[model samples]
Target chain A: MASLKNIVGGELKGYTELLQDARQEALNRMIDQAKQLGANAVVNVRFSTSSVAQGAAELYVYGTAVRLG
Target chain B: MFDSISIVIFGVLFIVGYLAGTINEKRHYKSIKKREEKLLSLPAISMKRLESSDGITKSELVSESVVVSIDYFKRALAILKVLIGGSVGPYESLIDRARREAVLRMKESAPGAAIIINVRVETSTIGNAANSKGAVGSVEALAYGTAVWK
Candidate 1:
């Protein structure tokens, strides 16, 4: 797969899919936490991605949970 | 002398990359335009708060990220650009597409939102080629905002 990417030199669809999945997972987890706190909404959202290993990355997401009256 | 077979291989790769890359970019841009038109009514603003929060009963955080890769042909152009020390045109479009796509996805995730406030977009390079020489790298764009609706 790596060799093919070097030759084709186009969008890495597989890697993109992987990252998207990871991001969605992180977002869902954040939402679940907010739900546990009885929050109807979350604001001031933020996200950051960092390479935790040679070939792995970590997607971190956070926001302020709030209940709208 | 450099091997002729390798030169031919390189040429083939370059042509293939160029053809495939152009098609991919055109299709992506077309989809982006259509989606942008469809979502035009939803306003996304960078301001921290709105003048009035009247009737805003719910709010939620929405975010999206996308990773776009460069084709061999464009990477070659960028490498030559490095020597001449000027802006890399190919990379500019790549980042543009990534940002727009990310924002679009963020908006899509909040279908019921009235408006998205405090929107932010950020970008970075990732993958094996990010810090190395002669390999292609991918650009990641993250867009986030708070979606509020009545």
Candidate 2:
């Protein structure tokens, strides 16, 4: 991958988009779970990412579900 | 022995990487400053909770993540720094940009919210080169918080 074109490094746009999409999907799932619990808000949200396999990564998101009056 | 042609090619690539990386970083910083000013009204705080939760009508989770790649020039600088045993200055701006961009996007996602609390920012390196040597890699920054509106 050290070709001449790769010499001048820049933003990996495709990888960026892919990670963003994966994160969004994880967040959406968390939100859905919170909704199922009849919670209107989630606080103290946190995100974690790990490379589970070569060329594969996992995004884990969690938070506290709460009802704001 | 190192071929003269290969050395010349390497030198050219280093120059190109430096020029392009500098320009890209400058443009990104400019954009970041502009957006930060535009979103100045909404504050994202790291406090887990507000002093008074009163009058908070609604709240929801908001987050944004970004992956930024490093240029060959900066990577070379980082390698050099590793040998010298000092701070890697070239990568600082890269991380800063990624973090700021993530936070900005998080704020953008919750436009109507009055404030964001319990904000958290996490970073990690991702890409084929992340674990390998002699290759460029990307950093991922994730920002999250709870946006509340009164």
Candidate 3:
């Protein structure tokens, strides 16, 4: 989340399951990204999202990936 | 005859929905108000550094999240917003509710922690369409931080 947005807008989905699946998928992808970057740990993890169309939403996750000795 | 019956059914649903949605929104707002009064006393901040180092012992990651659906009235209001291409008022409140709910949840996650630092909030939209005509406008908010004790 860059800034706390006061506006409330959401996606209209056909199946509720798809919505959750998207979130989970985003999380997995981010973690994998961190791992691939040779990060041993991720700190201060956060997520933000927005929709590109009527039925689709984009979930974004970010954090400080670090290596611990 | 069928048309009349369908009209009556929809009319009843509209009335019930209106009452339920308004009541729920008002109640949630009240709850947010009460919780905020307490959370404000704590030193919640965006920085990773702690304000005080006295008796500091615990550090852990804590998080809280909530999902809220847009009521029919809000959806209708948002539709009008879409037409005008301006700020969406109903969504503002929904997002507010989600954020505050996440904050309260963070407090509960670690009631004993003195302060939460490096806090962040993330939001997403998740609405389930009940029908072709009905728009399910739902949003989810997630807040997370490193909790510390002194």
Chain A TM-score of each candidate structure, as shown? 0.91, 0.87, 0.67
Q: What is the TM-score of each candidate against the true structure?
A: 0.82, 0.83, 0.69
Q: Is the docking of candidate 1 incorrect, acceptable, medium or high quality?
A: acceptable
* A8-69 per-residue lDDT for model 3 (tens digits): 22322223345447756877787799899999788767767677667566777777889889
lDDT of each residue in B1-150, candidate 2, tens digit only = 579988887788789989888888899899999999999999999988888989999888787777787776777788788789877787788899999999999999997889999898998877465425554467888888889998
The lDDT, on a scale of 0 to 1, for candidate 2 is: 0.81
In model 3, the runs with Cα more than 4 Å from the true position are A1-41, A48-62, A65-69, B1-7, B51-55, B127-135
Model 1 — TM-score against the truth?
0.82
For model 2, report DockQ. 0.45
iRMSD, model 1, in Å: 2.7
Query: Of models 1 and 2, which has the larger TM-score?
Result: 2
- Clash pairs, model 2 backbone: none
Candidate 1 residue lDDT tens string, A1-69: 643654444456677778879988988999999999999887677888887765677888888999999
Best by TM-score: 2
Candidate 1: pairs in clash: A9-B71
Residue-by-residue lDDT tens digits, candidate 2, A1-69: 323324555556677788889988988999999999999887667789988766688999887899889
lDDT of 3 by residue, B7-108 (tens): 887576556556766777788888889888977766567897865677889887776677677666566666677888988877788789888887788877
